[model samples]
Target: MSTPDRTANAPPLDQPAFARLPRDTGGPVFAEPWQAQAFAMAVRLSAAGWFTWQEWAQALGEQLRLAAARGEPDDGSHYYEHWLAALEQLVLAKGLSNREMLRERKEQWAEAYRLTPHGQPVELSAAMHGDHAHARVLGN
Candidate 1:
């Protein structure tokens, strides 16, 4: 399938930070820190040889196409949700991680986020594991 053209709304070259985004995407990309984090993680993983840029593009394109088919709003605000979904799919397909591992890690982060007081950063601690066994994973 042809990728949707998103260059019409991208931030211009004069805006250094946003210049890398496709020119058709809406201005003011990344609504939250986690969105940027997820984007960066995908890039980092790809750089680390987990997947190819073409594969990543195909996965994200498929996600966008599916969302569009579902009658979801394509206002671009939820683009990162599709990005994260694609990342999860790629990781699973590559056998880099499984659904259960992802779920458990998500639960750990959720618990950390929940226990964290508002306005404070969520951190995974040794205590969260009830032992230091998972401390190495946290270090990663």
Candidate 2:
């Protein structure tokens, strides 16, 4: 999808609200103002069974500080990657999902890959081969 165009006279990145905006890959300038706000909303909604606008503001503020320290500038960044990271952080913070669940999912996927005939696992069940099946014992 085409991204919306930002005005040339757009406000500065460090202005009143933009100064504390979260970094997002999508939006006006890769990491434009509202992208971070959107992510913060999702995280807040998923946590504490609440969605206070003030809490969202605080979360974005903290996220902006952390991203800036990590060298995330006013320019936009990879939106989906940042979104995933935010979700992970919120999940961990709220204890919604455990590390073991993530690890288990990773291992299960790895095993599925290993069991596939080629290096890549086939998504269709009919794609599995029985080449390794033992031949019937002589005259059973």
Candidate 3:
């Protein structure tokens, strides 16, 4: 499918809510490092042609609506959770990543995080790769 215009689905920059997103010298602001990473990942995946901006918006909107239906407080604290759900859904739908692979990777990350010292950044190590199947995947 042809890529949609980049500017079409973007929230207006002048809007107060849009402005409230934490910002640096450029781009949208995020409350935390992971939030920024999630935002960047979505932008990168979209630019890589995995999905269109409109599709991403729809997925995110749907996720938010579902959360609201489930009685999630819609006070914007869970915005990134919806973003992550949308990204995961789009990724799985597009066949870019499977649930099993994502689950395995998540386990690896969790293991790595658990083993790391509090002040140090977590890094996946060979010791964390319990089996041969993940050896190559973890190596990268």
Candidate 4:
């Protein structure tokens, strides 16, 4: 007997990759099914190699479990947060990224925030750094 091809067994990315939850029940701003769908689409696209999907999923799942354990009611966390948590988890699991990368990006945003004369923040993106840079600075 030979081992089967795992790649061939993999489900198509177009199919549902996650379970659905009641839209109206989980947190504000995510009270719509479309919002959840948007998050899912981002994850799926990242996983398909548009970026690092594994990293994103890892982060998102970790955040969700942490929130749940911290007494955050299931109804309280926004659906996007859960998606983000999973992303974080996947990142960490795959070593595609790390907390230091996140921390550094955050520090950059903070520095940008303080230096902006407009008392506003800056916006950071992968294009700005020429890499898959995470974190965003708003306002500026």
Off by over 4 Å in 1: 1-27, 117-120, 132-140
Question: Considering TM-score, where higher is better, how would the candidates rank from best to worst?
Answer: 3, 1, 4, 2
**Higher-ranked by TM-score: 1 or 2:** 1
Model 2 / residue 131 / CA error / Å:
24
How well does candidate 2 score on lDDT at residue 64?
61
Q: Per-residue lDDT for 118-140 in model 3, tens only? A: 98878877325554546544555
* lDDT, candidates in the order shown: 0.79, 0.53, 0.79, 0.58
lDDT order of candidates, top first? 3, 1, 4, 2
Off by over 4 Å in 4: 1-66, 119-140
Model 2 regions lying over 4 Å from their true place: 1-57, 110-140
Error of 2 at 53 (Å): 5.4
lDDT of 4 by residue, 1-140 (tens): 79877886764454233546545534465557756675776667585775575556556656766776675655534657677556555555557779888777666666555555674445553214444333333323
lDDT of 3 at 4: 75
- Give RMSD to native, each candidate: 10.0, 12.7, 8.1, 11.0
lDDT of 3 at 118: 90
Q: What is the alpha-carbon lDDT for the whole of candidate 3? A: 0.79
